[model samples]
Target: MSKRREIETLEIEKIVEKLCLKSNIILRADVLRALKKVCKNETKNPVAKKMLQLLVDNAKIAEKEKIAICQDTGLVTVFIEMGDKVIIRGGNIVDAVNKGVKEAYQKGYFRKSIVIDPIYRVNTGTNTPCIVHLDVVKGNKCKIIVMPKGFGSENKGRISMMNPTSSIETIEQFCVETVKIAGPDACPPYVIGIGLGGTMDFAALLSKRALLRPINLYNSSKHIAKMEKSLEKKINDLKIGIMGLGGISTVLGVNIETASTHIAGLPVAVSISCHALRSASAEI
Candidate 1:
């Protein structure tokens, strides 16, 4: 590979499409194991446990057959960490992404769940024009992380700006309440990502980005890890159970990340991920 890589536009297009298909079709193994582990340890009700088993089985079928587990393929989201020295050659990067999305959905036999106009509600059938976020980093390569944000969980995302005087207890309560309100709608045995101290949208994006971190890893910051553990306990206490059948496992894990903010306000955002938690990353 050339240090001055010339990644073609068509190549990007193809990659996006393939990624969408893969992400929609197969639940990642890490997500599957985490769900099983959380359910086994936290859930108590027999009925919920049974439902969880069904979910596990469903995931297996989706993986084996290469089919989407849910009809909603989700809004395509890309997180790009671009190295400072890397220059993309060939076509427009955005168009390359859209082209990739188009090809993948078509070739992979996945549903195209995008609408052309929000109000008119015209279906774009190809699932083109994915949501892409790019960041420039210090290296000479690019790392692309793809996460398909399904509406079920995405709809339940929450954001708030509290006074500087707001206590951590208040933030904790917000996290728990977000899950309770979402109930079974967002799917259970889910991962919770919390972000603090940013503007509204940035905070929300941070929360979602935090979910991209590996489930097995703990936050590097001791204070953040402690808060994550505490929130996880409180959320599990909700007893929303597996698939909201009402049991002990309301949440699988809570991961919190924070950043400094203005003295006048404390911003918080919470995002949830369903059991599938489909995500993939590659560096090139």
Candidate 2:
């Protein structure tokens, strides 16, 4: 028989802190590659080419200075993978994760963007109460990923309780409409994430989770992968380009994630990220 593994809450918090700092400072490799790819593809559009290169350059400076790639710094989002055989000590998982975020913000001196109340509009100060999602899978180790999700592209997200009878083109059109609406405001050379199942809230959550996937990869489903490629082409064809400047490359990549849901309900959500798609992960 296999023995259960014990994981200290302190260990989780420390790793979370390090990941928060690291992700905010460093641009993910896949995102960087996409930016460079667009630089090459947008040779005809001088403005687009220059803007895309600037983004790549900005990433380099942020890494060297050990500062946030984007000033918004974003509301912290944590995704945790807890192994079924593991047990935690010291404190609860959610509290530990939030503690790590608080420590990281203090240590790194990142911006405090979170507000306790939507209407009151008071700063949380500590950047506590970050978004956390935990999952139990078959394993013995806990894995954590921290993503600093800026509100720029996040606000551009859209959701629809798609009719169960909707066609593929209908879904594709909704995703395209979202990008056109986002335009330059959300920042361009964007990474588009789509979630295609589950309930209203879950679909939105899945959409954000979809953004965590590397832009270079495709979903496991054959048809889904095809749809991603199709949706990407459709979005770029809009010529929203880099920051709505008009170029061959509008979106860097499109990723779609799906989950099972009730037969009577069909839901879809779209999430997006700017060129500075910042995230980092650690396994313990």
Candidate 3:
């Protein structure tokens, strides 16, 4: 029999706390690089070029000062990959993550954006009950990824059910329209994550997960990668510009992840993320 590897709640909390704090303060290197490239190519629209430069400058300031990149800070989202042989001891995993989020928000001075109830709209104050997604895999090591998602771009996400026979052009058109509608509200110079196939909820989840992928990486499948590149060009053609000021550098990257779905439906979800694009990962 394989030996069970014990993982303590305290250990999880410490890792999550640090991940949250670091993710907020430090912009991912790939995203920073993409922003710089966009700035270089945004000469057609002086306003957009200037805005991209400001964003790059902002990231540098945030990193140097060790301060939260955006005032929103955002609600915490944790993705956990657990090994089958791993046994979480000492306390519950959810509790540990929540504790870590609370501590990070307090220590990092991140804004508490979560509400206790959707309708009542009362503030949770501590930002408890972080959104957690867990996937059990075959291994001995546990991996955790934390993404602090601001609603500015998140609220612009959209999901739709399409006929299974929908052509790629249809999918492309839908994505472009979504970006056009999002306009300034979603924040331009966005990272667009496209999730195709799966059920409605799963498609949405896949879109969100796609955002966690490295900005410079493309899907392994040649077809998917081509589609991603095509979508990026189409979205940029919308001329949304930086912060929707009408310029050439509208989208920084486009990522797509698909899963097998029912023959009857093709569910597509688009998740938009702003320039901050904050996330961090650790393995234990």
CA lDDT scores, all candidates in order: 0.80, 0.90, 0.91
* Per-residue lDDT value at 56 in model 3: 91
Instruction: Please provide, for model 1 over 96-172, each residue's C-alpha lDDT reduced to its tens digit, 9 standing for 90 to 100.
Output: 87777777778777778889998998988888668899898876777777888788998998988988898889989
**Clash totals in order:** 4, 0, 0
Give me the candidate number with maximum lDDT: 3
* Each prediction's TM-score versus the true structure: 0.93, 0.97, 0.97
- The sequence of per-residue lDDT tens digits that candidate 3 reaches over residues 1-284 is 55679999899999999999999999999999999998998777787788899999999899898889999888888999999999999989999999999999999888999999999999989977799999998877799999999999888999999999999999999998989888877667899988999999999989988999997999999999999999999988888888778877789899999999998999999999988898999999
- The full ranking of all candidates by lDDT, starting with the best, is 3, 2, 1
After superposing candidate 1 on the true structure, give the runs of residues whose Cα lies further than 4 Å from its correct spot: 1-5
Candidate 2 lDDT = 0.90
Candidate 3 contains a number of clashing pairs equal to 0
**CA error at residue 159 for candidate 3, angstroms:** 0.5
Which is the better candidate, 2 or 3, if ranked by lDDT? 3
